[model samples]
Target: MSDRTRNTPEMSQSAASRRVAKVGLDSLDNLWFQVGGTLCNLACEHCFISCSPQNDKFKMMSLAQIQPYLDEAVVLGVKEFYFTGGEPFLNDEIFDILEATLAIGPATVLTNGTIITNRRARELARLEANSIYSLEIRVSLDGFDEPSNDRLRGKGSFKLALNGITRLVEQGMLPILTAVQTWSEAEHERMLAGFKQLLADIGYTRPRFKIIPALDLGAYQQNKIGPAVTEYVTEEMLEDFDRSQLICSNSRMVTNSGVHVCPILIDYPDSRMGESLKATTGEYRLRHPACYTCYLSGAICSNFSSGGQSER
Candidate 1:
């Protein structure tokens, strides 16, 4: 769960289909790269982007393609960098890209932890050691056990992911384990306890967990993970709201196609804001269905967030 997608806003029948609100880019603090594009080793059922081995809709980004953006980001005073895709490790140039990014700012990579071999884990440690900034690895998992997790992420995925986490922990890299919120509110503590115990078993005594709000998009909604989005952020909604809480107010994602408003809406054509980061720093209409999710959950796609669903 990016702890993403659906935040069922209670609205009247007339307000059910309201006009989209406008959110401007106040600053460029964070920039994301679809570095792996849509090429992931595992096709998780709840993935908003629907990435997989066969899904090559967006190609892996090369170092040459990403350099210009990094240069522009430096000029913009961007403080952080994020990398995601079907899986960032799928790209051959991922380490190179990471090396270049860390030299400029702190970097975070979202991954499935399926392909983190001992060598790769060691490489990640080396990258962190070589940089002045920090390197964060966020590994995604569905459920705690084989049956619960494998049901959504593929067969034998639990073992593979567990091994990946273990390898990272052994290398002294405390990778954050991320999960989409699929259980009930009452089950939250129970589920977290289960995950804590699971991590402890893998020598991760100080485990960090990121509970993602499930986004009702792509394969997630297709698999009936959550209800279809039926609400939009209206101008009225922002009357007394904190505009800075929204991701579109300060973040932009870079895919091979172009710069997008946000990562959650990458599959939508209208999400593409502009060709470059500088050009894209303008007002964006919160028109996509996914915007409602972000409205309920404050900026669901940031490493600093620990599942922000309690506020506007």
Candidate 2:
């Protein structure tokens, strides 16, 4: 039997619950722009997309190509826009693209943080100063210190990311430092406290932080899949599951190829929605194990705003 069919009824239940948990795609008002696409500077050990400099599975979306969507999004009641990629800053036109995006609605960029140079910091400051909408940057850091961090991100990456955050603070922008949760309970608290201390020492006294669960995909496949006998989604959980909390239901990600259901399943062949955002709308099958992660986590990717639930 194939991996999908070999699972127990519990696994099928999990998958069904995921499908039911998805919000209506038509109700979606948030637009995610994949500016950097499938090209990232660093080849991290656990990147879900396996993004690297040469992985042009998806290409960059130019300012012109994305601008029309920004305008279209405003009409669709898209209150927020999200930018992500291999590394958004890798594109020379990233500032122009971000500036354009900020004009329509609040924008958030998920970045590795190692690429934020002094020039980019100045641009970020300018974007915040002139725009009526807000701009937030989420910097991904695996650990508070070098040894723990470099283990996942690579040598010298820890220091470089810290430098990027330090620059954001210096530019008068408060950035959210995101870490993946991979430590024991005691170690986890210690890690949080360490981050707090590090931020204070670095002059970002009120630094925001988000810790994420590592999804079993890409490089993580080598580590292991979900538990040996993990449960899938089922219809029963839909009784109380908040479909709006699930990103795939309402939010569609625009990639180089076209649109996809969500960011997590970009590399999945069947996850492709269509050739355009207008063509991609409706239900998505929660067939993959990763779907179960979203179902159980309840908004792991898009749940947070600066201080409140994401403006849906």
Candidate 3:
């Protein structure tokens, strides 16, 4: 493990036991499937999970493994489903999984967008069209142009992702373009406008967008030169705050390894609640440093943009 990851607040059992705030599971509203595991086709410099071609710390889940959870989620009255991974599209049964998920509830997939071909986009459109529930595809793009995005994602990634978005647009799908907040807050408006214009140029006029705050994990943690999270959440801090804003209050991530508290903390051992969703219930302590990020940024992993509302 990286020193930064090792130094996370979750690692200090004694300190965490004393200072952490407990968050109970309000309901099982959102179900996330870690379908692709830690295996992406392209390894982005700032990836939270350090997903790559060979990282197998978590293995890809098969359709057979996921079906049982889908059935259970239905019984639990799950309102929405989310698919994420090294890259969810990398999974061979991604379409099948999405099809099954959309049949039950609204579904969203978090993808890097490089693997979305014209054929694949058309198929995705068909799935969305057939489903009664909403189907949202969130594409990750670091920048509006080639140089800026390629710098973080890798060479030739910008062009490929742009092409994929274009195809999705052509297939009548409105995808949510997600970018990490790599620049200062002062530059947010300028960067957002640039992205809007870029998407408009490619026929994605009035594109939906979401900005994500960078987390200190994966490759970012390995480098350990960025701003470090210094604050830990306390019970006193939740006095006047809306606890509903926390993803853990409404969601749980199902992975091949086990059912995790949330999608962001799957790498942390303590985040693994149990082997099954039914087995994982009750409250979870905000012990990881990443919890501070979530505390500061309400449900950062959700489909909606934070827009300063995350900070209480």
The candidate scoring highest on TM-score is 3
lDDT of each: 0.86, 0.77, 0.85
The stretch of ten residues in a row with the least summed lDDT in candidate 3 is 303-312
- Tens-digit lDDT track for model 1 on 1-312? 223334435333445445558888887878999999898889888888788788998999999999999999999989789999989998999999999999998999999999999999999999999999989999988898999899899998899999999999999998999999888899999899999999998789999888888888888887887778777788888888877778998789999999999988888777898899989988887866678788887767887642232244
Model 2 C-alpha lDDT per residue in residues 1-312, reported as the tens digit of each score: 011233434344654444443334845556787899878888777777777878887888899888877776666677778889888988888888988888777888899999899889989989988999889899999888899888888888999999999999999999999887767667888899999998999999998988877776665554453343254454565566666666776688888777788888787777888876676777776666677777777667763762223343
- When summed lDDT is taken over every stretch of 10 residues in candidate 2, the lowest stretch is 1-10
> Which of candidates 2 and 3 reaches a greater lDDT?
3
Candidate 1: C-alpha lDDT: 0.86
Model 3 agreement with the true structure over 1-312: per-residue lDDT tens digits = 223336645456785567678997877888998999989899888888888898888889998999999999888878788999989988989999888888888899999999999889999999999989889999999999999999889999999999999999999999999998888999999999999999999998979988988887777667562687756678888889988788888899999989999999888888899988888877898877778888888878877632223344
Candidate 3: stretches off by over 4 Å:
1-5, 9-16, 305-312
Minimum summed lDDT over a 10-residue window in model 1 is located at 1-10
Please give the distance, in angstroms, between residue 219's alpha carbon in candidate 3 and its true position after superposition: 1.1
Best by lDDT: 1
**Candidate 2, position 212, lDDT:** 79
